[model samples]
Target chain A: MPFWLDAVRRFERAIGVPVERFVTSDAYFDLLPHLKRAQSQLEDAVAAMTEEWYRLVNLPSGSDVRQMREQLSRMERQIERLTKQLADRDATGPTPTVRKRDQNG
Target chain B: MWPLLGSDLAGRVGRDLERSLWRARNGLRYVQAMSRPREGATPKDVVWKRDRAELWRYRSETPIRYAPPVVIVHSLVSRSYILDLRPGSSHVEYLLAQGFDVFMLDWGIPDERDADNSFETYVDEYMPLAVDAALAVSGAHEVTLSGYCLGGVFGILYAASYSEPPVRNLVLLATPIDFSQMGPMVAAVASGRLDTAELLDETGNVPPDALYTGFYMQAPTKEIAQYATLLENLWNDEFVDAYQAMAQWSRDHVPLPGAATRQIVDDLIRRNVLASGRWELGGREIDFGDVQANVLNAVAVKDNVVPLAVTEPVMQLVGEPSKRDELRLTGGHVTFGAGSHAFKHTLPALSRWLADHSDELDSPKER
Candidate 1:
């Protein structure tokens, strides 16, 4: 599986939804990557979603396959870059968040 | 003394002594809220309301009862009741009416064991358990998850670190991603005047009273002088009731576990790791990109604890579609969940957004 798909599947489970329909739909697969702006993306997605994506992810404002793909793609890359680094072996242990308290009664 | 022992004189002395004894009776355990009580959770100004844990399960009300639920995970410092204060003021109640099966985690004040608790415990234990408990209660196949302030960070961590998190639309309110920019308090913790290690050692959990005092001192006038003014200006029953309720809530501090407090300081505040997306909790590495749900980022314009400066960094990390709408509320931190205004401003926007994007989420892995 593609790194994006592998990562997307994990988040899909985390988010709890199907993806094949989302990625395969005609309206989304051909979505342009350049028009990543939220507003235009929403307008275009709403226009296309009336047919293709009204179900997979029920976003309030209409967002197209192009924008959703862009967003998810960005997220996928981020997760991959971040998690891959942490997965390295020289890692000691995860640091813990601390709060100090004065012992005096 | 013997000469003045007449009944009348002695009785007078006895009365004086009794008055002195009576005055001394007020012991200082949990510092009592001095002013009269007031209503704690009335919606002064709100918009929409409702909640649920996962996607598809937390939906808007009416023609939408079948709407999926949205679970709201609240911060540890404040009470969840803030989300559901008065009828006109309740966030959870509004969501219920909106058709979302609302599940909320009220991390009731931490005791001694809670002190031993670490951030890992919250991410691994409390949050997951809360998610599981909510699922069992609602019996929903999926749920939507949202959080405010500390809870927001927890939501992100839980979603990112775990291969399977029970959430759909991920919402964050007044949550900070970059601790390096957190105002004076963060500076203090970063420095050691607010010695987290020492404080934790004294008691397993840092006392709520001390934390409240620190926060109060951050804005002493707001905590003290303002209340005195409000008392003078508002004389109505509702005013008094509201004052008392808020007063009680403010004073009702929950002890933070020593370990958890330590980790927060060392990992986030001190190391400034969460922003770098290098934070870890509960034996899992937190990767913000791991969160790919439809996100609704609501920020407060004048948030002191989680300032907008830090918030922007958090949103940018989402990697999700930045919506045609990012809501910046026009009030303090608490207004997002309290008052009638929240319905109009906060909940409606939230529920409407969640409803529109509920299905992009998945369910828990079957055991």
Candidate 2:
């Protein structure tokens, strides 16, 4: 093995133990929520800015496309469900209508 | 003494320089190889698809195994191509060659619309349907369900919920049942360090990067170690190809549905529902003791993502001790699917187990 390679492996092995312990430790995990919150806020800001840019340029934004696609998908699912229901009803035959017995009685 | 030390130092420097040059040359080749497309090499047909998820049957010229079909349940976080990575290094190919009918449940990328897709939907609705599809296409009455990572969690839940499950044998590959042992990922959620609710609500979905980054944080030195190993083995063609293929798969992550993420937070991470057997779905309590399928729980000894402690509890949970089996493999998280040792030991062991328990084959008249 190369001298540098040996050194690198040694360094990795040395740090691997402590790093694994620390990374999974309670102290580390406890701080993640705040970091995640900040990250979410940052992402929101960037998304808003991108949308604004799209509006200014008179081009369709990502959110707009997503919304439209979602609408289309929803319609497709509704149609599929309806089609299945129609098939089932046909297979099962029509339900009988209730008799007008109250007036006769 | 000074002259001897000087000569020794010179010789060491000379050897280092030569090795560095060789590594640099190979490293360049590694880079070039990486640019090529490197996943899903096996030909497959989408036998069935529902919404974003699809059940794929790999095409094979070899005769099918007499055992019931095997369907791989991929994790929600990653794509399914990792199993069918390349021709030589594919788990799907090996299973196919071993005569097992291989199918994969690929949960394609989820969008904002899938935000409401919850655990109940996956375990109760989609999973059972997928199993039915696999059984239908293969002409098998039951399927040997093989769950990888989070997929195993879903598999366990499904098996527990259904009294007469379509699954004949349950194989869990590095699946985490005890969330408390999931290290930093669970710790973050358990301690309120990572507010899964706020993140899901704000974003409507957990993007691929967010999920990937969470795993990355668990082992910060993993990438460095991986690259260093790559550099060392850059000269080997086989190593380079495998590395490139795996690296490509690693980058291709899928966004997890928001509702599912919420369930993960509340049920698994925070409350430890699966471990406690208190998780109920579709009016059925998910008790592993109810699962009657022959269970093969394989846990990786060196798995950093899902630690050994995280996976070991499932043996006790199963109803029958005689039917329960465990294998401690010698690789980390991704190795069960991609490692050479897996192809040698893990896949073959699983195949034997399936064949051994095959009801159709065991029955003389049916055979």
Candidate 3:
């Protein structure tokens, strides 16, 4: 390692302690919720605009596509369950039946 | 004294010049992306597949000496390559050498199809079938279930849910049991300040970048520090390769399914179900005391991803006191599977505990 790089590392270490402390502090966490709320509000605004644009264009919105995909995923899950049941049945084979008394008896 | 000092200075200058040249050469290669390090290069055959999940049986020339095979369950939000990171530093490779028949359950990259995959889907549906497949392939009645991170939560659910779980031994690596201590991002969701629904994109999943951002926020300056270190060590090929592989893995995250995220936030984080011992999955109450498998909960001392406080409670909740053990390992979260610390300390300790619990085969079975 170079001498200059070592000095840079030393500087980094000096500042890093306080930076890390602040990042993990209660104040940072308290500030995060507000930031998250603002982000969510912005996302909602964009989504509403996108939906309106899709309505004007006579095209399905992203939300619509998501719903359809979710429905398809549900059907896929059902099919998977059915397939698993069939496989389980095949593995177990048919249940044995009780034999009746002979006709001669 | 002056002559000696002059000679020493000259020697230092000469060495520094040589290193600078090597650094320049290596930096050029790095920028061009030349001689990229290969990762997850260990040979493995997919023994079973369902949806995006695949159970991989690692190929080994050595004979299997253990009765019950080891089945690794990886976390959903990351690639499974971390376990088999590189040939020399792979946990899978280490286990193979230790004479355990190893199988890894990799939840492949998820998109729209897996948006509805919840805890029940993993714990109830996929895990049981994956375990059965591993058992059938290895001709073993039971298996040693090793789960990493979120996967370990699934292992806990699976073992506790079943009356007779086929797991003979359970190993949890850096698995979060108390989500309240999982840092600010999770705390936001837990406190209901940040809704999980807002995190989901149109694909009905939390995007990879979102997950990456969450992790990145934990140590915002770490990336800058790492790059500085990387630049300094650019002359060393071994260091360069290791750095590249680890850096790639750190940035690489997969989308988390929306339904699973919701459940995780509500049940695990908000309610703190795992810690409280009051979790219900698929109408069945999950009780950790019901887990009959001998448990080994390994918590990394310096894991920012899943802090020690987040994982330490598992030692109290799981199985009988006599049947459970905790390993407090040194280093960060990835140390259990990758890097020098794993090869030196983590693997040996894990293998020793696993071997002690495992039954030896009368004769070794060839691959």
Q: Measured against the native two-chain assembly using Cα atoms, what DockQ does each of the candidate structures obtain, in the order listed? A: 0.01, 0.19, 0.15
Q: Give, for candidate 2 chain B, the lowest lDDT window spanning 10 residues.
A: B358-367
lDDT per residue, candidate 1, A1-105, as tens digits?
A: 346545544554543333333432334323422232455468656677574555556653344454565466456546654664665345453321211111220
Residue-wise lDDT of candidate 1 within B1-367, one digit each (tens)? Answer: 6776787798988976764454333211113535433333422221112111121222332333433457777787666667766555677667766555666665655654344456665676456656655565566545677788888888877766665555666788888788877775576566654455445423356667767765654444343333443434343445544554556666666677677777788887888787886565544456687675666778877777688888777656763545323678876677676644576787788777776775422432221
Candidate 3: C-alpha RMSD after superposition: 6.3
Residues A29-73 of candidate 2: C-alpha lDDT, one tens digit per residue: 666666767787898788789999999999998778867767775
* TM-score of candidate 2 relative to the true fold: 0.80
Docking model 2 quality class: incorrect
User: Using Cα atoms with residue i matched to residue i, what is each candidate's TM-score against the true structure?
Assistant: 0.61, 0.80, 0.85
Q: Give me the candidate number with maximum lDDT.
A: 3
Tell me the lDDT of model 3 at A67.
83
Which stretches of model 1 miss by more than 4 angstroms? A1-105, B1-66, B223-225, B322-325, B359-367
Interface Cα RMSD of candidate 1: 27.5
Ranking by TM-score: 3, 2, 1
Q: Find the 10 residues in a row with the least total lDDT in model 1 chain B.
A: B46-55
- Fraction of true interface contacts that also occur in model 1: 0.00
Pick out the ten consecutive residues of candidate 3 chain B with the lowest summed lDDT. B32-41
lDDT of 2 by residue, B1-367 (tens): 9999999999989977876786777778767866665548789899877678888898888777466888899899887888888787788888788677889998888876567788877786578778877776677778888999999888887777765777788989988888988875677677676777665533377888877777677667767667777778765667877887888777777888888888888888888887875577666566677777889998889898889999998888854688999988888888766878778877777777777876434432211
User: A1-105, model 3: which lDDT tens digit per residue?
Assistant: 668778777777787778778866778877876887788788778988999999998999877877888788778767877886888678663221211112221
